[model samples]
Target chain A: MAQMKSANVRLEKLNKHYHRVVAVEDVSLAIEPGSMVALLGPSGCGKTTCLRMIAGLVQPSSGEIFINEQRVTRVPVHKRNIGMLFQNYALFPHMTVAENIAFGLDMRGVGKADAGKRVTGALDLVQLGKFSDRFPSQLSGGQQQRVALARALVIEPAMLLLDEPLGALDKGLRESMQVELRALQRRLGLTTVMVTHDQDEALTMADRIVVMRDGRLEQVGGATEIYQKPASRFVATFLGASNLFSGKIETRDGAGALVAVAEGFGLLVDGLSNEAREATVSVRPEAIVVEPLGNGAPRTEVPNSVVATIDQVVYRGFINHYYLKLPGGSEIIAYQQNRTSEGASSFAPGDKVIARWDASSNHVLPNG
Target chain B: MSGRLEGVGAWVLYCVTAAMMIFILAPLLVVMSVSVSDSYFVTFPPQGFTLSWYAKVLQDRDFLDALQLSAVLAFSTTMGSLLLGVPAAFALVRGSFLGQSFLKSLVLSPLVFPALVTGLALLQLLSSFGSGDARLNLLIGHIVVTAPYVVRTVVSSLQLMDINLEEAARTLGASRMKTFWRVTLPQIAPGVAAGSLFAFMVSFDNYPISMWLANSEYSPVPLVLMRQLVNVFDPSVPAMSTIIILLAVVGVLILERLVGLRRAVAI
Candidate 1:
């Protein structure tokens, strides 16, 4: 059902400075048509500033914005024809759901019959067909958000911008709405840009994730590329749980590079070239396997293995997280999934265990 | 023993509040009762109930003329105040300008200035203009007196509003002007209405400003009532005062119904 209206958005070296504070530094990004890109960062990391610049709510100190290859840097927000869903939903309290949805159409001088039809269709799209007569105060937060989405969509904007759309919802509601909104965006084929500080939301919903830090773009790539092959130490630590082992590269092999740990332990990481002689290697906790040392169990043919004492064991409902301390006093975490039939291993704190992982599982990130 | 003492203290407080209410309302009740009295002389208690004085006051051409003049003055003053006050409030609250604090203080200074002083100042200023138009002078004086209330109410309401709502509207394809009309104005409508009501009441019930500014040909209700009370011993004076009180009460009630009484007062 996707119509595939060209939604290519290009931002070229956008910059915004408030007095002496640089809100958004020099940043450039190209979003493909029909793609959902999430600008993910911590608070004040320039994600909202970028979204505002795209929406024309904020003027960039320098640079240009292009929609479908047409430069629209100087255009005002109203003329930009982009839909925005605010964090608060911002549904008009005085207006009923139908009137809220019909506002843009009314401003465009659409006739009563046509505007009403479009409002109904938009409300139905959000599955709020029976709530046309209810004011915003009567609706729940999720319902209000749906009404806001319908209002924006009724205008059939060129692009849709969601600024922390689900940030106000409860945990379960936020998860469900994320999936529902992603489905709607895909179904409508609307080029969408969403700003969020939630890493899980970005990973779950975005086709591409742009990681930002201190008003600069740290990395921009697919979810797997950002999570597995983060370009910098900041990206590695920000996107997910990773145990970073700081060291200098010792030797380069065809498969991976060998790195010298702080003390005596040596580590091997995949996809590192010889040129990367000084780098930080990151290993995800879920990638490491843990077993009792000298247990006589058949080991996988992974490149790097170390025997460490368990420093802490945190039993989560689905998995157990083990913090392992190596001989050199550096620590790494390993997760063991809990199966009812097999039961969890009795690995308590201070127990010694062998931690192992394939060389391919390790990622070498540039030092910030 | 402590709970008993607390209950006794609460009862004492309630009795004091009730006494205060009675003190405030007694004169108004007396005026209303005397308005309907059958006796020609002003008395604390009416011997008989009658609507003759009200009918006499309503039929009097002088009283009717004064009432019409007061209505016209009140309405024009309210309109004038809103025109000057809404923008001033907007600028003071939203615009970052040099000497903004001074500007805000200047806009609200009329509230601090005594009405008699303001009236005398306007009289001197109007006389210097040499137009000799009493109605014009009264309008200018009333505008000065009422505009501050409008500004204060509107600014308070604007401060309470969620500024993000307007930004959200702008992002939803609304231009700046459209955002003001569609989002900002609706949110502050209650405050504006309340401000206009206060402005009207101030202009209508004002004596010091109206007495100084009004000529023999044009007198507001309060000025005319004061003139009749001082010059003539008319029993219909209470009837006229009663009507003025009723009008004020009615205006407040209508305003409360339109917005909300609590919200209006708070703003």
Candidate 2:
């Protein structure tokens, strides 16, 4: 059944300008059939603007939107046949749960008997079958969110749009709903686009993540590519914790290049272009290894190693983070997983430590 | 010493509030007392208890005509204000347009304008437009005086509503009109009912506007009562005043039941 109704969307050079401010600029993306894509960014980063344009609530300044190869940029919002779950759920306060879910089918001119069956099925899918007669105010927050999801799905729209769907939920509920919503989407093979500022939500649910910044696209890739190989400094910082080292290229070696840091440290990195004069290198915090100075260990020594003092230590449940101050006053963060057998780190604040990473772990970024 | 001062302040506040209540209710109470008087002349104190004055006032043809005219005018004003004011409130609150602040002030400005001035202006404008009938002029005057209350009340309710509800409706395949009728209208129904009631009462009890616009033969109930108070010393005058007071009280109670009294007044 899912294979019979696959959904595809193609946005072509979409631009939305509100008076003097350009809300979304030249954004073009193709969402594959039966996959979830997330537009991840901070507030005022144009993620919501892009979603609104796709929902046909905001007209683009210049672009064409195609849903299943049909241009729908000029279509009226109601006539577009799309479903959206608002951040606040937006269930009709006066209507019961069943009536809210039946609203779309009724608007589409479906018969009462058929609409009732679909409403029941939709409610059952969301596990709210018995609460169909309750008003929105009578339900819990989580139940209301599910009813909103059910209402959107009952229409079986060509594509589903969720705008910060879990923003109003508590932390634990948000995490659980992320898993539940992802499973539902996969089970139904519904094409979905979600707008969220949370990196964890994007990584956990979306098959592809489009990171936006300042009303423009920063990078669009799978979770691993976006995290492991960020195209820019903003993407690297926005997606996760990364230690950025500013350096100038000194020379080129076989399959690597040498760089000179400001703090009297020379390092070699892999995958650096020969013509690159200066670069900002990003290394993930978890990729760095911290040890006591002068501890003899054999590892790949092609990259940077900094002698630094541990400034602060934050212990999360499964990991410990160390903030290290390098010789040149630059700060770097390193994360170490807590193993059951290994005790906690002996290094305290103000203790000298050697922070090291392999050359291949660093990705050279263009300075902006 | 501080505690003693607080007690003294509380007593003073209670006295002031009681005085205000008596000041506001004095006229209505006097009219009620005079309506049951057995004396033939209208006065503050009754000579004796009787209902014959009420019966006499109720049967008078001129008084009935004035009462019917006031009712018709009040009903028409309420309907007209709702039709005009609700949409104006929606536009002022929800729409993003240039001069929105200016437009809002313009809609509510009639509240601050003197009723006599508005009545005179409407009378002049209507005569220029070839409307010489007293009822038409009075209807126009009442609409002008009452529209601001409707606009203000509806706008207050519109501000409290969640705008995302309308967006959600649109996303669910509801057209703009359907979204309004199904979602926006229900949320603001209390305000709409309260505003119309206020419009009706203001038009019904208005004197300054009716005096300037009404012809001698077609005066509203309030204007007629005022004329009787000036011209005659009959007990029927108080009886008629008592009836008018009761009608106003009923209108207020109905509004309070529809929407809370506190909200209607605050809005």
User: Which segments of model 2 are wrong by more than 4 Å?
Assistant: A1-4, A295-302, A366-368, B1-18, B255-267
Best of the candidates, DockQ: 2
lDDT of 1 by residue, A54-138 (tens): 9998999999999999999999888888989999988877788898888888878899998888888888889999999998888
Reference-based lDDT, each prediction? 0.87, 0.88
| Candidate 2 residue-wise lDDT, A1-368, digit = tens | 12226679999999999898999998999999999999999999999999999999998999999999999999989988788999999998878899999999988889999999999989998999899988898888899999999998888888899999999999999999999999988988889999999999999999999999989999999999999989898999999998877778887776477877776576777776656777777889998999888656533343578778999999886889999998788788999998978777668999988888777787877543
* Candidate 2 residue lDDT tens string, B121-200: 88888888999899988888899889899999999989988898888889889999999998898778888987998899
Clashing pairs in 2: none
